[model samples]
Target: MTRREAGLTLVLMDRLRTQRLPRLQAMHARVTAGDCLDAHDLRYLCVSLEETQRMKSPSIDTREAIRAVLARLYHEITTQALSNEQARFRHAAH
Candidate 1:
């Protein structure tokens, strides 16, 4: 790869390590603990999902690993969120 491409990839990886990874890990912890995601959390995830679609390029070598974690997070969060909604619906129905 050219120097510029290498530099950009490095920057992207650094951002992933420093910013995205920590936040994702935290959210994973929260969701795994049965806490519902707030509006800001949902919005952040929505934007991240959108960005991930756009970020699928050759330079970002760790994309698959990141995506795997993201998929797990999505599963946990959605499962909890759906459970919460179902409980609310049942409560209302009663």
Candidate 2:
């Protein structure tokens, strides 16, 4: 990646960490706590994850590592949401 690309990626990563990640974490917590997540929340998480995954760093290894961490967090949020939904369904059935 060029210097400009690396700078842009750094800015994007900072924004993700400072702004998007907090909101995503909050929503994940709510979902795990049995609060319903609307379409907007899901869309935001998906888009943010996609954008993070696409970011390019000056170093290939650094970029891959950063993407891996972000992707893992996104995956955890998804898994928690799915587990919550299943639990809710089971409760309803019971």
Candidate 3:
């Protein structure tokens, strides 16, 4: 799906779900929808998540901030984590 992201029309990657919507609005890049992840990307995700968590404002509840981060990660991970029936069906198809 096309979105007005970062002033560009992007087909967002499902692997990069973002809690920082404003940052996305400023720097989104068009990519495949529901894209799959690889090791390097996973490493980046972990590092970025850690870095962002560290930079989080102390005024806000840290738990809430972490939840938002995890929520975004969940959104991406779920894009690949198949449901029971879908898992079987995909395996069969493959």
TM-score: which candidate is best? 2
lDDT of 2 at 8: 85
lDDT (CA) per prediction: 0.71, 0.81, 0.44
* Span of 10 residues, lowest total lDDT, candidate 3: 6-15
Clashing pairs in 3: 6-25
In TM-score terms, candidate 2 sits at 0.79
lDDT of 2 at 46: 78
lDDT of 2 by residue, 1-94 (tens): 6778878888898997899878878987887687766788789987897788778877789878878777877887888888887887899999
- In model 1, the runs with Cα more than 4 Å from the true position are 1-6, 56-62, 88-94
Worst 10 residues of 2 by lDDT: 28-37
Please identify which of the two predictions, 1 or 2, would achieve the higher TM-score against the true structure.
Answer: 2
In model 1, the worst 10-residue window by lDDT is 52-61
lDDT of 3 by residue, 10-77 (tens): 21222234544443322222112333455654575566555444443323575466558655654545
- Cα lDDT over the full model 3: 0.44
Of 2 and 3, the candidate ranking higher by TM-score? 2
Cα-based lDDT at residue 43, candidate 3:
71
Model 2 residue 69 distance off true place after TM-score fit, in angstroms: 1.2
